[model samples]
Target chain A: MEPAGGSCLLGKWGHPVLQAANDTFRLNADFFDYTIIALYFAVVLGIGVLAKRQVSSSIDFFMSGRSLPAWVTGLAFISANLGAVEIMGMSANGAEFGVATFHYFWIGAVPAMLFLGIVMMPFYYGSGVRSVPEFMRRRFGTGAHLVNALSFSVAQLLIAGINLYLLATIVNRLLGWPLWVSLIVAAVVVLSYITLGGLSAAIYNEVLQFFVIVAALTPLTIVALHKVGGWEGIKDKVQPGPEQLSSWPGTDLTGISDPLWSTIGIVFGLGFVLSFGYWTTNFVEVQRAMASESLSSARRAPIIGAFPKMFIPFIVIIPGMAAAIIIPEITNLKSGEGDTGGATYNDAILLLMRDLLPNGMLGVAIAGLLASFMAGMAANISAFNTVFSYDLWQQYVKKDKPDAYYTFVGRIATVAATVIAIGTAWFASNYDNLMNYLQTLFGFFNAPLFATFILGMFWKRMTATAGWTGLVSGTAAAVAVAFLSEDAFGSASTGLIGLSGQGASFAAAGAAFVVDIAVSVVVTLFTRPRDEKDLKGLVYSLTPKESLVDPDAKALPWYQSPTTLAGIGLVIVIVLNLLFR
Target chain B: MSTDHDGTTDTTPKKRAGLFDIRFVIAGLIGVYGVILVLLGIFNASDEELARGDGLNINLWAGLGMLVGAAVFAVWARLRPVVVPVED
Candidate 1:
């Protein structure tokens, strides 16, 4: 009836024009929501049906027939990287931490991507493998493959669950629709496209959505900047205050906050251990590597993906800053009980959009939000089906199933993942209250899993025995830590056990990695190597004729090519730290 | 099964020069970092200068350097050997 929920729109001056503009965003007794949502569904369905004709075999279905160009794979790669959790979580972080929230994009993501491009991609592409797990088996053993596949799947499911929850949250807040209605509708839309189009459909739709989301939101940022009086207005509103924003070496360094030990601990444990481990091993991302058209393309996907990856802070994080500025009255409210729906900084950006965006633009923003959600969904579903069809089903169940059968199973896996994600989404409706619960669950599997993958990759000495030991040990350590802690999250120290919840999981994971590496090394030394022929296909880089034999040719003294670029980038990054600090 | 048979051999290299394009990789990564640095330097430089309570300093040198770096790299890559040949 009114433009927005505030008392102003419904009051005496509430006219028909404003009401119509508001109604576009307003979920309704009217058919507007249905009409728009149905149009989205129809478009995806049409693409899926079209993609169906192109699906000739398992390869065609899972990898878009492996005929995708660099542009297609590149776009899909980006959309897959940014999901519902990205928009909601990062936006929330932006509101809470201000500019410091941007550190995750710059510090956490960008370097990791470049390093992945240079170091990790070469290894993966060289392996000539279908999946990261397959790469694991060639380097380590089947044991490594099994551990990686299961841990990765669990992580993906948790991610999907988080995404489903965020999507439901947005829809629920907008229309006052029940969570199940939203989750089910989302599940159907996602499942339909992925099942029909396979990875190619996912990639195609993702590329479309990538453009849609970026195009739609990019202009809104300009308008927002304009409204906020450009640069000076932004500075006046929030000036990088402490507790709101800080840089890498700022509060953590210089004794501004803590001792050197705590600072070092954050850098080592959080920065190197947690961050590097995730970027290198995480499947939702590495899956893109497998989809590249060439070794070089595979290598470039993560790096190319890094470019837009840096802009995420500009597009998503700054909006939260703007939100804080325009909605300063609610800044305290964000931290307090004055919140609507699920009260937290997570919903702050959505709250801003609800208040600020004019009529037609609101629809576009909503589409961007939905596009982000679908991108995450398509990425995870394809990954799940990939692991399921390739690793689990192929290894344990019907090893000799036809490609067509695997394609069929890939579709079935999508449905199965959708069902599990729906249930997890329902549980995640309480995510604001259960942040620790979600993250702790992730840390348990992720910590040890990361160790195994990293050790397997860099250290050729790792063995199957070490792999299994690390996998089991990490999970047990994570679970035990989570269980013993007074806080819902795992503590690194306990009076009884002398370990905190966070500390325990880290120690457990780290110890497991150490043990896994040691065991793998010792066992590999004693045990025999795999068939050298099996290892033949690995070697992803294409060297020149002279360089191919010389092993040192075209090396360029390490400071001329990627290394030089990365070094310069690092210097600029340091300068950025000083400036932002 | 037929598709598996028809799949390109990943084990063997094409051996031919320009089989996979090195320029694309260089151009792509260069373009990526280029756009990122330039945009971040331009807008964020102004913001940083403003936040420093100074008059508008656009980080003109840095911005220009970024553009030059990107263009030089892109042109250099095109001039380098073209590998990873497409169907075309």
Candidate 2:
């Protein structure tokens, strides 16, 4: 039980988990491929050892001592998010929905990230809170802090489990290994690095993983696109409709049959509510930006991140779209021509990779997949440990402990959370499309938290009691919607209407957001407001003008300035939307 | 440690994260893999393998592309090694 899942972690894990087909479609990954993966693991562990030497305090452990530059944190910001969900789940969406899938990128992500950088980041960075929960604690008192900390911790563990299950499933199918062995091995690799160097190790490894992911996926996309004649070829091949090529009013992508309601859902439910809720308030990504050396760099982190983000769907989603055309199993499944060969949309990326890549490149792609899954889980685990140790443990159980004690507590929390994640992976195994499950989790956790946060940050009059009540009621509303809606919880749902897939998650999110705002407003009007004196840097209007932007920023050129760079990002994304629309 | 001529000892290096600058690690690893893939592409290509993605020697082309990526990252990291103090 204590050997940390055996000493031979990489030796067993080095086998590329590529095939989902029975025997007819094997990955054919040879010696060079395994060697590449093995070498990548060596560098990954080596990074842990290097980063460990930098950690001497709790701040250093959990926040990288807030010393990382903007570029590193910026790259880490996006990389930490380039987990199993982005690679596998988005690609799955692509295989199912085609070019309409780009909505998740251009509409669902970029604008919110730019907004986080330009508008909301000032309060977060200007206030000297260690974690998002700590910020909540200062603003709303213990009730809100406890609720935020507990829910955020639970969400991280569950999301980490999703990454764990998919990685293990891939290993199980490809190598016929037992699920426990694969799960343990995958868990141990992330566990080793995070426990050793903490967030510093996680951030550095994320930057590496980001590049490996780009390098690995670019080849696969080019090859897949070449195999099909191009986007024109894919459109012609997957005939019978032109709707797949358009990004707006995506009835199929949203899982809502009515084009009008689907556009409303995509815009209000997804583009505004869920995206802002996740991108702005979620601590997992926020932690990266928080680790930056300067407030301006912190502010610039997400804006810098948005540049690469604008183009990622071209590589991720397009390949999945190609798979639906190029691969026989998926083609049959999409066209209803024959049996699906037991392949789901989740296997779209792996199926395509198995069909196209050669041995050496195959190894690189496998390593890339492994990097992404680990990056996602590592982000979750690192965030979990920080909140557990600092916000939960130190605040409630062991107050006034030495900083070193908290650092030790953080390491222990990482180990414990990784083990718990192994158990939660079972829950994720029930879903065929992980995006639905992930979106449901976000709707439940992030939507309500975003409502509580956005209200408190802007309105200053919202009291402590309003904060926790709004959070609880908002979450309950989302869960209630999920339960009443058709196909959200499978058998648990009442099948109340035709709502299904991403549309159901969006409905749940929308319900949470509206209910949370309404409840918070009502609760605030009834309760005593916090003193305006206490709301100095925490609230928008209360905060001084000087606190928001760096004084040195005025001297810097337009490209380096946060708002200027963000404007550039906005224009490019708008053009991308225009071109794709 | 020797004191300065002004008799002031140096501040502890707690703030310096070293110019080991993580980009070198990113570049070096990607470059190594790129080189290996290029080697394999050159040595182990059959006509059947060449015909897989429009007869384009994918491993070789991908390897070259990665090497270019590695160079760009390494150059970016070197040209602007940002470790000095800035306004808080």
Candidate 3:
């Protein structure tokens, strides 16, 4: 028998059982696998080449000529948001935390996506704004626009680099490829497509990637479920603590490790604040919706995405939960141990693929992994270029540049963003729990954003000064809460200021959101409101009836209406929540 | 909004052929991968390989599914090629 705690020791590999497990878990791809992966790359590059012909102007480059249909944009909408973190980290969380991780999908993503489609898209699409920050410029004036644009651009660059870093690390671990090799390859591929076809290239690749990832993962999930004896078998073998199994997080808050897993935190912080902020304000995701052929198409994009978003948890979360039972040692896989021994929780999906999948299927799964990482990085790169060129360079640095000039600058921005992303990735290497840090960073950026957007869209009385002040103050509040909580509770505390990671982020965002609203309301009362005529189509109350209604929507069958589709989506979400609960 | 050098508005819609569309890329990938898997499933099976797949050639089935998906995208693209809209 192996040692009690350190069973993953080098000597343990010699043991018969350990040898079998380790052999299967190592990189086992053959010539066939490499051929499949090479074919995928060739196809991606060819697509990039073909897409370049469509790019004649800055608008086409940045917004896909705003001509995408509902199905295309809708699929791309969800795919753009499906980062390496969503596939790997969510699975890691599933293995570690169990059913509670589903909250990130259902409570955290679905409702917000629906809200974006049904409520917010009218203002965004009808106004003919090129980007999310442009919406800010029209609604609140230049100051708010600058703040949002700068923050988003910087964040996108950092995120793109992180995506590169993650892809490299996963490739290094899975294929035994060197880190530099994976990074350069990913950078080259992403830059090629993004710079060539622009947003259209990115969106098309994203839609393609969505199917590839699903096809890749579906087999693994099916095989793993069969290996583990099915759903009941997974539950029986997992032997999780009560909190791990319970979806109603409030009931077993004390038993759960993270304070953020608390029902209140999940609902308020992830569900409301972060979800709304991200789905509504983040242009990386919303850019897909905005690219639709019509206002109604834009409205239907996120609604369509919501249906698939509901089912994603099954593909992503189940593998992790199954791994928890089948390869329990994965959860204990720590950092710093050599490649073979220290397989961390993040290796949950990888471990399952290695153990369960045969040769040809394994190659496809790895390709899917590559596709997901590229899709995520491409999304951020495209968003970064758009925001930098239009919002920053055009607005501030070089006003009245020709359409071609802006398009040229956008391509140049893609290269610059990739460089900065690499730098951020190198800097991020110093952090231990990169995903946790990312979540906190997201909270800081997004929480205050939702507050600003909600008030700006709904309340015409809100002043431009208030808009800028609320955003700045809300971000500051979130940052202050994160730092102060760590200091007060001691760095080692799991729940700082009486909250878990998600909870802490929620608290910070919640505090920031409240502070932004309070400050905005107080300041708006004292300040002058924008002219009602000036607010036409920009504010909810001032938008015209024609702009508000989707002419095609009324003509469509009842099931095809955005409202009915959203209702169906909500029903699925509620059912999933109940089933898991 | 900018006038052309000849002083006329540029009204030509920017649209590409369905073959050059990005969906074609999806089709090409799915088709290529599907064909490869189907070939492998039929001819290249050792006893160990069969055991590894638990006697079920998942490659053949998945490959067929992927081929169908590719055909759907191809048809969709052929039916409605992307057309770059006139700027509002």
- Which numbered prediction scores highest in TM-score against the true structure? 2
Distance (Å) between predicted and true CA of A465, model 2? 1.1
TM-score for candidate 2, please give it: 0.92
CA lDDT, every prediction? Answer: 0.56, 0.80, 0.75
- Index of the highest-DockQ prediction: 2
- Using lDDT as the measure, what is the rank order of every candidate, best first? 2, 3, 1
Off by over 4 Å in 3: A1-25, A241-243, A250-261, A331-340, A430-439, A486-496, B1-16, B21-23, B46-56, B74-88
Clashes of each: 24, 0, 3
Tens digit of per-residue lDDT, candidate 3, span B1-88: 1110122246775544446566777788888888877887787766676665456666777778788888998987777666543444
On DockQ, the stronger of 2 and 3 is 2
* Candidate 2: tens digits of C-alpha lDDT, residues A1-581: 00000000000011121222243344677788889989999999999988887787899899998887787888888887887767776787688788777887888888989998998888898998888998999899999999889978877887687678777876666555687898999999999999999999999999999999998999999999989998778878763468878888888777788889998988887788878887888788889999987789889999999999888899999999999988888888888889777777768888988778888898999999889888888998998899999899999999997789999999999999998889877655544345334435444766687788889999989999999999888888988887887767666789785677667777877899899999999999999999999888999999998988887779666877999999999999999998878
Error of 2 at B3 (Å): 26
Backbone clashes (count) for model 3: 3
In candidate 1, what are the lDDT values of residues A219-304, reduced to their tens digit?
A: 44554555567756766776444545555443322122444543453455445554555666666667766576655555556666
The C-alpha interface RMSD of every prediction is 12.8, 6.4, 6.5
> What 10-residue stretch in candidate 1 chain A is worst by lDDT?
A1-10
